[model samples]
Target chain A: MSATLDDLDRRLLWALQDDLPLRERPFAVLAARLGVNEDEVLQRLRRYLAEGIVTRFGPFFQVERMGGAFCLAAMAVPEERFEEVAATVGAFPQVAHNYRREHALNMWFVLAATRPEGIAEVAWAIEDAVSLRVWLFPKEREYFVRLRLRP
Target chain B: MNGEALFVPDERDRALMLATQAGLPLEARPYHALAERLGWAPEEVFARLARLRAAGVIRRIAAAPNHYALGYVANGMSVWDVEDERVDEIGRWLAEQGEVSHCYRRPRALPLWRYNLFAMFHARERSEVERAVAAAAVRLAARFPGAVRAHEVLFSSRILKKTGVRLDF
Candidate 1:
């Protein structure tokens, strides 16, 4: 869906995405910088959330730094077993996000654990429980990309 | 899903989520630092994060230090065409690996874009990604003989923008 962004709204978004400043009264600081009131800052934020401009507005952890292992996985699921397999996969604590794709390998999701070895364990668990062949596609390197929305 | 309902974040939880998404202080006491800045109690800050976690809004609050700067330079998006009967299990298994961080199953394109399962892999060098892909291919071929009809790998050239979270206030 298209996002309707005004000057003020864009300002707020730009500031927040860059990283809130470190200081007492950050809202006030932001407001002053944007030439608006703290309440206005809060109100606009509320509107933004209500408008669904943001899918998630919370802290995201660095799995590796946090002593955890995370990876993205996909499987080709039969039509009849879609829901059952999705539920099973989602039940795992490591499975963070699950999606239904239109392909032979329709099921996809993420998995994370405290240890690197846990990767294989979780994968095996799902394979055994689901009774399907599983593939382990791990990241060999890292590339950080921050997607920004233009105002 | 309706676009309106899909993007809306609850008002009560906006402040905390916004703070984290915007970015957190790289300090010993990050939570405390945020509390001091927001003029709220440290416990309050932690409490909000906990609530967000429980609510499935904030999945995890942590850092994604500069990957490229740190030397993990190789990365690629791999797509596979696995049999529908085994894709679900295979996807879950793949996600359980540490190397694959981003996984998705998009609607398959016709003859040209037959690979439906997409997974992101990061390595210190392009060779690492190739090795991983080859290994994964071998595993798949052994596990599901004659199952995967095709596969493709696309490396990321230049990262444009990747942050998706938006906090309006």
Candidate 2:
């Protein structure tokens, strides 16, 4: 959750969230549309990124058709082992996000394996390393997973 | 396989995608319609989208095809007690099924949680989904002994909201 953004910030965010200028000097293009100078556009974006309000201002791909596999997994790690488990699991290139929830299943993350089997290997490796049972909760149906950020 | 980074769309392209995803107005010349709202050329809008597809930002800009809108309604998350050696093999089989949309191997619970392999299936009703899962389980079990352990069919109760990424630039 985030606070409401100012009008100018909202408009700028709407543009970036939906689309970003693909040119080398994308800021210049965005500035022209905003009726602001390129420097101002760049500075605002830098500030936003620094603030963590914009976790990632980049592109994301739909991997299924491209022959990639991804899934979300959670594990009930003891509070004492949270740091150790997270560090070990987070090291994998396939692991996208890892977070601690407030339930018996506290640790969760999304892993994208280049190959389908790679997912199993990663899961097994983590289980062995952590000496904990990992519950694989792959999305049965992606009814909805999108997040709406209205600045 | 490694591919070039997904293309980030320009403003016009973004507008088109957002408009479409947010629920397109059932009006003629939808592209032109949105173009007017954005004060841009419709051709410019189409061209930007074409560039986006070429760049791989969009997998496809087609209709909702199979699940949400169409007839198949019941959705359930299927979990399996697959061995570390056989989970990948089982996941691939699930991926090939028409009813299966999402498939992956997640970490299992340390001692009691033996189910690590999971897949999602959708159908018209709860019965339809149950039948599909029964068939899938049989296929999975035939390949690996004691493959199926606990499969929970949690039906979706409500939809809070569904939208894409938040951009606050």
Q: Candidates' TM-scores?
A: 0.49, 0.48
**lDDT of candidate 1 over B1-169, digit per residue (tens):** 1122222335535666546655655343557887887778987877766754554444444333333433455666778887767776667666655678656555454543566577777777788887998788888788778878878776644332234322232
Residue B156 C-alpha lDDT in model 1:
49
* DockQ by candidate, in order: 0.06, 0.05
List model 1 lDDT by residue over A1-151, tens digit each.
3465677876777675554443445567768988998878766665555555543343664445423466656677787987788778776766765655444556656667656787788899999989986665565333323433334
Worst 10 residues of 1 chain A by lDDT: A141-150
lDDT of 2 by residue, A61-124 (tens): 4544334566676788887887777788777666766655444666766766645676788888
Docking quality tier of candidate 2? Answer: incorrect
Alpha-carbon RMSD to native, per candidate: 14.5, 13.5
Model 2 / residue B57 / CA error / Å = 5.6
True contacts kept of each: 0.08, 0.05
Q: Cα deviation in Å at residue B88, candidate 1? A: 0.7
**Predicted model with the maximum DockQ:** 1
